[model samples]
Target: MGMITWNCTEVEEFILLGLTRRPGMQIVLFVIFLISYVISLKGNVLIIFISRISPRLHTPMYFFLSNLSFLDIWYTSSIVPKMLINLLSFKKSISFHGCFTQLFIHLCLGGSECYLLLAMAYDRYVAICSPLHYTTIMHSSLCIKMASGCWIGGLINSLIHTLFALRLSFCGPNVINHFFCEVPSVLELSCTDASLNKTIIFFCAMLVVMGPFFLIIITYGYIINSILKINTSVGRKKAFSTCASHITVVTLFYGTIIFMYMRPGDIHVANQDKMATLFYSVVTPMLNPLIYTLRNKEVKGVLLEITRKRHVP
Candidate 1:
């Protein structure tokens, strides 16, 4: 059972006016998005495959990277493909339940990515701060538990947010201005006082977003300090190189996320929102495999050897 009414009793479906309002913009969006989707899937899937097949990558860092790639695949799978279809269709409509389902799955996957990054940061911290203990701290069993915990934790957190939305009294005007069933978008359609929902969202943001950000800041602050104490130039350079790629990825992922959600809802532009969705959805997934793997010589060597053998044979 559910409860959420605005002014009217029913709203069967919603029109998704994705991205741009211009009639001619659909074609451009389609071509660009199609390429992005293919690249995104290929990039993320290749990482998981490489991690599985390459014995050298059976370490704690790669294990988390594999899980991150898997999460990317699941996350992008939730939103981008359906969005591609909607670009061409004249009736860009989705049922209420369909919207909520999309909402749930998207949050489940996206939130998981947030936690995965945090885990990866911790991994980097261990590797750098306590080199002697890194192996012992991040064993296979612990790795599995950490990854599983991330998925479960993200789902529970997303569930709490989504249920709040489900309980709202959506009486009428079911048209969500944005491309997806974002919490703010759904809340806007409700007739009843959504102060509770707003409060919950704020609290969730503090826990999910601010919490991670603070922890990451502290981790990196220590990392920078540790790097400075190294006497040899080569040691400092080596230390900086090891963490540089991870830091870049973290910055890009969190920067866009902060920009998109941490704002007054009144200022939102649907097209900009769609583009913001693209950052974490399409771009970040493609980036993780390319950026992280490319930075690591071992993965690149393995990739080259595999490619060369495939071409030769």
Candidate 2:
């Protein structure tokens, strides 16, 4: 066991061995990451614009969609900008507090995203399965409440876990394997008995991560069942189409997540960890607006009409 010490004077910053050390790959990584950042920003902002323009889309569903887009924008923006700079620059060090702040906000947004996905699934299920009460159950105030819950719950959860992680002592091996400061990566640096940290983190995960995931699955299960029961072919198609985009986004986000951090870090390939982290953190957030907003007819219609009207006068 690495000897534990709490000498704040001992450490000021930590080195991060990012995605790759190969200087040859720097330019290639910069180009690809730059494109991703651009697309992500455009896609999410477009969603927000469309949601605001379309009167017909001012319902609970679109309200949540708008929030989701906002979250995606900030979520990716939190990591990708700094990471892109690190990829191009020789300096790849992060201040100890900055690292903790990044981890805190990252986990908070990630947790909220998980719940937002589930909330969306629930919205779909109610619209399809219990159409009569859809309005009552998903009222404007209720929608706001649910969205608030996602953000507030995520903030509290992030605070709890990050506090525990922060208390642990870091020793000699100050370099993190991944690009950013994740819970597990930071815990690995601790020079103390990490079992307590691990246990607390595990509990936090059950409540914050795994719990929402299971709820999403249950909601989708009902959604699928309700779709299958529709009598006419067109009815089923309509029901499925309403959800296809959200479902696709959910699968992409959650699939990568479960595959990445659900299991113990030991069995997985160490080098691939950064790649998996990239998928959920960068790739998924960038693609979310595309999957949920761009292909959505209402969103697209609103966007087109807004742009045309702006030039009309």
Candidate 3:
């Protein structure tokens, strides 16, 4: 065991070859990403604030939306700040510990969002299908429990991946092609046989990504069925409107994720992978609050009310 371990000189740090090396392109990318980061922060914070202050927005739907917005804040934060710093810096590097910590946090939040979306879908299902018992079924206590479970599940999933990553030995050639420390990119740098890591990643992707996705699909099927059953066209339209935002979010998020992780190994391209990661990691979080607020009338009315009150004073 000692002799085997001695064969590898473990690297203490990694050189991140961020999004671009061209000086002009770096500046352009920095400005774009910086603006995106600011927007993401402001939008998600506003969602959380409005959800808390407005009594009309105190339902299970908004409750989950607030949780989702909070998750987006940290999710984008975990990678974007470090990425932005590296964009402008000459020697773009991250310590071994820092890289892994980012990986753990990124995965934790991503996994958590999957279940949170599922919870939101379930909320819609309850509201549309079983309208009379919606309040009783999705009570405050149950909502809290579901939200807590999503976090706990993500924590465990991230722990498993992080622990498996820790077992690998990195010898030399510590340059990571991506801006952030994702599991796939890090695994490529490992000197040891990483077949186990690949296997585990695929296995967990099925559980964490595909599992919730399929469940969401099934839940929506029931929701649609119930909505169609309503005799009035106006009622059906109203029911569909409530789910539009969530469906859009799910499509954007899950499409990129599946394209990134679920495909065959032969088709993988580094640049394509990077772009997909950017969309889901950076772009999706920024768009979430906009999607929710623009599609949601109640949230818009509350925002208008707050704006008018502030101006009156």
RMSD of each: 2.5, 2.8, 2.1
> Tens digits of per-residue lDDT for model 1 on 93-188?
788888888889987887777788888888888988998999999888988998998898789878987887777667688677766677777778
Clashes per candidate (backbone, < 3 Å): 11, 0, 0
lDDT of 2 at 235: 98
Ranking by TM-score: 3, 2, 1
TM-score: model 3 vs. ground truth: 0.96
What are the runs in model 3 whose C-alpha is more than 4 Å off? 1-9
Superior by TM-score: candidate 2 or candidate 3: 3
| Model 3: per-residue Cα lDDT over 71-118, one tens digit each | 999999999999999988989999998999999999999999989999
- Shift of residue 9 alpha carbon in model 1, Å: 5.7
- Residue pairs of candidate 2 with colliding backbone atoms: none
- TM match of model 1 to true structure: 0.93
Off by over 4 Å in 1: 1-9, 264-271
Candidates 1 and 3, the one with greater lDDT? 3
lDDT of each: 0.80, 0.83, 0.92
- For candidate 2, what is the total of clashing residue pairs? 0
What lDDT is reached at residue 169 by model 3? 87
